[model samples]
Target: MKFTEEHEWLRPEDDVIVVGITQHAATQLGDIVFVELPEVGTEVTKDDEVVVIESVKAASDILAPLDGEIVEINEALPDNPALVNEDPQGEAWFFKIRPSEPQQMDEYMDEAGYLALIS
Candidate 1:
């Protein structure tokens, strides 16, 4: 998993990269109530806002960590937003992207770097 300074995480799977907020971001957001995800095929540049996660605290935007076309969205989130606070790095993933520049992964933070940032 690669992490962005904004707290989004990217996990490459086969030919796509899964996108989600990190546990730290979810924790800070409080209980998530809604998630607005873009349709499949939506193109986004690196750092572009792709989804909005609403919580008791405030609405937060989840940005694309790399340039890509969105391929899939987690359809279950609108009904079960707490999945984000419950399992942020897994079932709570917001979407998957088919990257235009896979090499951009190298620019994201590794686990140790992400942990250090939040600490």
Candidate 2:
């Protein structure tokens, strides 16, 4: 997985890439209450606001870390938003995309780099 400065994370899964906010972002957001994801067929560019996560503190956009076409979304979010806080990097993932430029994944930060960035 890779992380973006905007706090979004990307994990490769076969031909698609899973995307979500980092654990740090979930912590900063407080308790997540709702999530808004783009439609399955939507096309997005790097840094595009593809998802919106609403927390007790505030609502924040979860940007796309790479250009891609949305292929799927976590249907469980609306009914169970806290999953974002409970497992931001796991079952809480927001969406999946078929990347337009897979190489862009390497341009983002690694786990250690992301940790240093937050620190």
Candidate 3:
């Protein structure tokens, strides 16, 4: 999966969605401190405001990757914000959503494309 200029990534599986910050975003965020995720069953639209990530420098809003119903939230972030900084591409992910609009994925940049922009 790639990312958006806003620093969100979308991994759309068969019936689930995985959302996370890109490595580029993690680098920019610095030391993560806290996270605010929407509750399960919340209805969200494409690019909706859904999460709040606090870093040593400031807090950033984590936008929804697609229009979907929030199926699950990563409750783990409240205590281990460092995970976002330590491994943004792995376990540090924000949540899993059942995407309602898969076509929005086309709006995001591919890994290579996003890397170029950040580079």
Candidate 4:
């Protein structure tokens, strides 16, 4: 898994990358009440806003970490947004993307680096 400075995490699955916010981000957002995910087939560029999340504290957008095609989304989030607060790095993942430039992932931080950043 790799982490971005924006607090997003990317895990490389079989042929796709699973994307979601880190636990630190969920904690900062407070209680999540709403989620707006992008369409599965949508094409996205690095830094594009792909997921919108509303929390008690504020609304935030999850940016695309790499150029890719959104292939799948967590359909459960719209109905149970609190799952983001519950299991941010696991089941609450926002989407899976098929990266057009997989090597872009190398630019992100490792777990140790991310922890240091937040610390």
Task: Report lDDT (CA) for all predictions.
Answer: 0.92, 0.89, 0.85, 0.97
Can you tell me which runs of candidate 3 are displaced by over 4 Å?
Answer: none
Give the residue spans of candidate 4 off by over 4 A: none
lDDT of 3 by residue, 1-119 (tens): 75788877777667887899988889988899989889999999976889999998998898887888998878888889899988888888788888777777787898888888888
Q: What is the C-alpha lDDT profile of model 1 across 1-119, one tens digit per residue?
A: 89989998889899999989989999999999989999999999987878999999899888788898999999999889999999999999999999999999999999999999999
lDDT of 3 at 77: 86
Clashes counted in candidate 1 amount to 0
Q: Quick one: best TM-score, which candidate? A: 4
Q: Against the true structure, candidate 4 has what lDDT?
A: 0.97
For residue 65, model 4's alpha carbon misses the true position, in angstroms, by: 0.4
RMSD of each: 0.8, 0.9, 1.2, 0.5
Return the lDDT, model 2, position 26. Answer: 88
Q: How good is model 4 by TM-score?
A: 0.99
As a whole number from 0 to 100, the lDDT of residue 30 in candidate 4 is: 96
| Candidate 1 lDDT trough over 10 residues, lowest sum | 57-66
